[model samples]
Target: MRVVNIHERVYRAEPDALGALLGTLASRGDRLWPVGAWPKMAFDRPLQVGATGGHGPIGYRVEAYRPGRSVWFAFLRPAGFAGGHGLEIEALGEGRTLLRHRLEMTISGVARLSWPLAFRPLHDALVEDALTRAEIELDLPPTVRRWSPRVRVLRWIVSGGSARPQALAG
Candidate 1:
């Protein structure tokens, strides 16, 4: 089966500013991913086509890259998650833009079980937190006021009650 996940957030900042922020996502995942919340996003070297490294156990190689714009990483681990994921920035004009993360893949075997039972819930919460972090980086108010019950429960179960999202000031 194929699975796809997409998340987006709009920011009121210069297009270039948003793009610059997005570029940092590769090496500076701490800026994007909440702390102590699941595994942090990390990569070796700056994002560029053909560079290798990714977050946690799921390995990846930089499949595509555009400075201050977008980047895609093709997965290289965790069996059956055969595809790629990445982030992009889109200009909306006059000091506004959009940031998006997309994961598209064909899944089979173990991933089918792990995704819904563990990764799915965690992934949803992480994406939301990432967007909130963006707001904080831009000195804007947070959009996520509180963690959802589902997310909280899932985090406890998955991370042994140690999942502390690097929440933005709400």
Candidate 2:
């Protein structure tokens, strides 16, 4: 089955400002990736086509890129997850931007079961935390969270104690 998962947040910053943060998405020391609750998105080099990295179990290589705009990473691991995920900035005007993270893939074989069972919940939380961190950097408030009990439970199951939920400060 081909599944697409998209998560997005609006930030109180221009597209350029928010897009520049991509430089930090794929590096061990990326100051922009939220460290407290999400896996650090890291790559061996700067964000560019062919650059490879991922947040942990999920892995990908940069398939397309636009500086200060968008990036798409084609999955390289968790076999059968054949497609791509990426970050995009949509200029919402009036000094605001919409930051979007999207995952699109055709799940087959073991990945079909693994993605929903092991990845979805934690992935959702991680994306939200990353966006919240971006909002904080832009001097805005974190988005209101909707962590359902099922999500929380899934987090605990996948990440062990590291899935501890934090107070979403506005």
Candidate 3:
């Protein structure tokens, strides 16, 4: 298995707002596809909770959902090996949310040994790019100091340190 990508974004929206986003995505599952819905969509089909799809296939599943709190999804590609991929959304304050995404995979023998050198940089770059896109898709404002210093730092870290600091009034 190989780690494909990871991404995250911070949103200045309440859990309710975040929940609304999830609901929108879920409702449009078929259209959003992939992380939300893909391969097939059947209203009667059970929500996939474990290793799914078949040999050499690439698929993703919604792993967890906590209304008004968090939502996670796992993407997988077939291999003799096992691994995980997903994202977490955490409420930071009354109107703030933090998203963290991670992609992990397991390899064996020679493949495992060479993975570090071959895949790490690619995975890092992909994750960063994905996060940036998520920020825009979610309409998360670029980090600004509407909150306390601690919150600002939290936003900065989650934004992958790419956000410009908001000017402070003298």
Candidate ordering by lDDT (highest first): 2, 1, 3
User: If scored against the real structure, what TM-score would every candidate get?
Assistant: 0.86, 0.86, 0.48
Instruction: Give model 1 RMSD, 1 decimal.
Output: 2.3
Tens-place lDDT digits, model 1, residues 1-170: 88989999889987687676777665645466555544766666776788887666678889998888888889998788899888888988878889899999998998999888777776777778788878887888779847678777776676677766644565
Candidate 1 has what TM-score? 0.86
In angstroms, how far off is 28's CA in candidate 2?
5.2
* Per-residue lDDT of candidate 2, residues 62-120 (tens digit): 99998888888999997878998888999999988999999988999998788897677
The C-alpha stretches of model 1 lying farther than 4 A from their native spots are 28-30, 36-38
- Put down candidate 3 lDDT per residue, 6-66, tens digits, no spaces: 5566677665654544443334342212231112222223333442432113345657656
What residue runs in model 2 are displaced by over 4 Å at the alpha carbon?
A: 144-146, 160-163, 167-170
Model 1 accuracy (lDDT, Cα)? 0.77
What lDDT score goes with residue 90 in model 3? Answer: 76
